[model samples]
Target: MKTCKEKALEWGISDRSVNNMCKTGKIPGVMKEKGVWKIPDDASRPVDKRVTSGKYIKRELQEEIKPLPIGISDYVRAQSEYYYVDKTLLIKEFLDQKPLVSLFTRPRRFGKTLNMDMLRVFFEISEENTAKYFVDKKIWRCGAEYRAHQGKYPVIFLTFKDVKFDTWEATLDKIRGLLQEEYGRHRELLTSDRLVEYEKEYFLKILNGNAGEVELTASLERLSKMLCTYYNRAPIIIIDEYDTPIQEGYSKDFYEEIIGFMRNFFSGAFKDNKNLSYGFLTGILRIAQESIFSGLNNLTVNSVMDEEYDNYFGFTETEVQALLEYYKVSEKKKELREWYDGYLFGNEDIYNPWSVINYISRGCIPQAYWVNTGKNEILEDVLKIATDDITEKLYSLLQGEKVVARIDQNVVYRSIAEDPANIYSLLLVAGYLKTPKKELQMDGSYLCEVSIPNREIAAVYKTEILSHLLQIGAITRTTANKIAESLFANDHSKLQKAIGEYMDKSISFYDAGAEGFYHGLVLGLIALMDNQYKITSNRESGDGRYDISMFPREARYPGIIMELKWQKDMDIESLDVLADEALDQIDDRRYDADMKNDGMKDILKFGIAFSGKRVSVKTNR
Candidate 1:
């Protein structure tokens, strides 16, 4: 029989992690005395018998990697009725040994904070009150020994996401408040009787918001040691959003100062404490060692390239189908698979578990939906950093050619200047773009051109931004329109790149299809034109169909009808073909059919063909 302490060594997991598993009945262990818990016999038995046996009582929930309305303490148990894929097995594999002291990583929404939360819920025991609420979930049904390990180890969980302090003092105070709050809850579990006076005064000083860094570090150390003494167990620690402070604080010196505190603070917790069991951490970026995690070692990083645990935090295909079946959303199986199911978390193809569940919960099939779960602060910086390269790509779009390149999904947050070869990689990794398909090449690269996909983003890029011309702060929308028209009528060549760059800067630029590209160019061209008329879509063109209609200032005679063509898809004579098509569409749909009604006579039309950077604009006879 191995004591709980010994199993921590054998498994190399944080004490809190092991404790959670044991509490949830995922591991085999038992309580022999009031203070002693032991794991006797076969330790491989699962907490959830159905999951371990490759069968689910609620057959449809095997895909729900994440379950139920989160943070609702009342709904603690893993709801077997809701879809939840077993990630414990995946995590058990990911943490085959002790993790590195610190790790920074970038994953899509489903991959970031949620994974960290899972780590926190699994590892920490000091806050067992929170864990107590989850004891009845599906995963805790049969593993009796696990239930025995409850209330054993001490754990600390801190998240950098909520940090909004502007000064070092403020930041330290915030951390102190958090630590004190946790300390206040488990003061009874601390057995540092020898340092009783020191700990009490430290807690008081922190409560008063006047704790010094030296004293703060010392207090945290005391808490760690006390937890060790009372529980007769080592401390386990997990941090969520570790890189948030550094990222949100970028270009600001306050960030580095705060980083200095956290770096030293965490190093002491994990390094100075010999009774420390293990640690697990998650954040968007792996800050360079020169700055973030200065002296800490012994961290085994599990990142995008680390494929061993790819399936640990994401939704798998099988899981998706199972969930659909469980929720009786089977009808949406194919649609969900196509839209939100294309992410890859290693070699395993994964889906957006969040989107899938949201759709199921709201009883709606997948659509453009709630992709805005994350704030675009970092995304804005990425855009500002990518102005030049993004501009070039926008120019390429005008040629009706979707830019293609090799991409490393993590390079979006990379510390390097924008490079031409890395654009696609940066975009795809940043979640602003995605690869619809991959074509492998003999040269050890992928022939993939990443692009935006969804009605919401589509409307954003082409509709709103395109409908108006950009302006300086002092320039009103009307004045901006005047300047834009003047710029267009005078010089379109320079204005083309200007609009491309502007669109890239201001919009969620898409890999516009042929029709989309043509409309984008038309909009750019119009931005430099006047704002005298409404920019309407599909007016009197057959039964509700027209690519676009640009009305000019005042009541003009014949409004312009700009027909379009992608010559490469057709032939060199396609211009003539488009010209003929425009004549027919214009006449049949009566494009000028309402000119008389509008107190106008003539009808203006243009046929445009775009190919590999050159645009041929011709007018109707």
Candidate 2:
């Protein structure tokens, strides 16, 4: 029998992992004595999926699908070991146009980082024989025009997706670690006769992770220059999720420090750096000008709304159909489309590849896979501090309705709070919202009609954003229960009194002049009955929009409709008349026509009028 350490060394897994496996009884015939494990001499080496490595192989892997490549974004391993969708044509398309600097922004989990890694493998002059991984891929058939560029250039690939530090100091340390790893790859530069002694010293400092802040900031540009001199070719720079640090900083109260550092770092590396042949960046949002890309005029941004390169990020309908067919679940295509295939990128309908893959891998059971994979803390943070106007629009979106807004593809993080439109713009880039119909204006701007993408995203809004609204609006369980009790009993007076008390307590709700504030509050109150009623908002059944409507899912309970009005120029005495006017409008407009058409009997309609903290509610049979 061999000890645990011996078994770990033989199997090439960590000792801790081997110990854990032994403790969990995964390893057969293992004996423990005096705190040491004795593993069997002939024990098989169980598969180690934690790390990827082999003798004399940096990225080589055996072809199999036993351990599925769920989150493996590395092109080398994914191509060799997993069921890979051929997105290699993305390389051909990118090379065909060959923009000087390209920024492709898509929502998270749309294969942005994986594509960036593919570009690195294809372009970087490495000894991994990366071309062999793409032998049967689509890019291989694009002829010599594209094939000639493979393994031809020096490449600098960096992903800043994990630089989420609380302080600028920790952020710098994280960046230094990444730089050190990169610099270690080119450590032969220290012995190169062409480089000066001081340059060698600077490179050594970088590899040791002891470089000064200034040295680290200029590290990329310096590395590119060094690589150009070594390889006699300008390096292709690819940065993945480049805006992650800035986004985190803005949400975490260190925006200025990060932006200042990144602006200088990017300007030095990208602006007028002769060592750069071309650069590619992938991020969730294209941060606005005068921030990161200051004075860089040669940059080209291709957002989700852009027609060019739209098919490169997400899975197209045909691609998803083929994927389902390959898995022999072709009959489930419709179900998949309804849940995950509503993302409209330009004119093509796209599916969330991450969610679809997980769904298939998990026996074709549908789930909110994409939404649950990561924390939507950034979005929730922004919404918690949202003004009344933004909250109302968000409520409309939650109700499965569209809103027209001027979408700025470029999102400025610093101004996101002050500018309400920035919230919509950020959500658009982050995949929380999608534009169905977009019109280009004469002034080079876009007027977008945006809404929630699909049921999955709407589920996220309901769980995360709506729950936050409930908390911010101070609609507690007691309050929600009280409101529901009043609605079920059709007690308009008690409901009005309860709502007026709530409005009085919330200073922001009372002070908000936007009509949506009152509308959203009523909707939020009704949302508490989501378990008991099929609540809907702004459904067009009559001549005009009805503010709120609730139909009990079971026929035994009564259906309810509500119309809300804001008394703009009225005293306390005028509220009753305004409330009566609301009731008259609800009947005159026939707002309950759809509910009645659905065979809903004994519908309860309520007209609610609001003037600041005073609420007047009237119900009719």
Error of 2 at 129 (Å): 2.1
How far does residue 83 in candidate 1 sit from its true spot (Å)?
Answer: 5.0
lDDT of 2 by residue, 369-425 (tens): 999988897567667667766766776786667899888876576567567677777
List lDDT for all candidates, in order: 0.52, 0.78
Question: TM-score for model 2?
Answer: 0.80
Off by over 4 Å in 1: 1-83, 100-108, 111-117, 120-152, 164-172, 189-196, 217-222, 251-253, 271-273, 365-370, 394-430, 433-621
Instruction: Write the residue-wise lDDT of candidate 1 on 1-621 in tens digits.
Output: 655544543343334545556677666456556665667644753434344433654442343233443322111233222334555443344344446354535454554555555555655564335443234332334355444444455776666667665566666667777776766666564345645666667656765657778777665566667677667877767676766665545544476676677667766776646767766677655554434445556765655434667776557888887777756768877777656765554467777666666777776655554355544444334334444345445433322235666654334243434454555554454444445556666754467765553333332333223333342121235444543654545433443334334433332233324555455445454333433344444456544466556555455323556555554444436645664665566556666545446665544555555543334455552
Which RMSD values do the candidates have, in order?
13.6, 9.8
lDDT against true structure, model 1: 0.52
Assess every candidate by TM-score: 0.58, 0.80
Which model scores highest in lDDT? 2
Q: lDDT (0-100) at residue 189 of candidate 2?
A: 75
Best by TM-score: 2
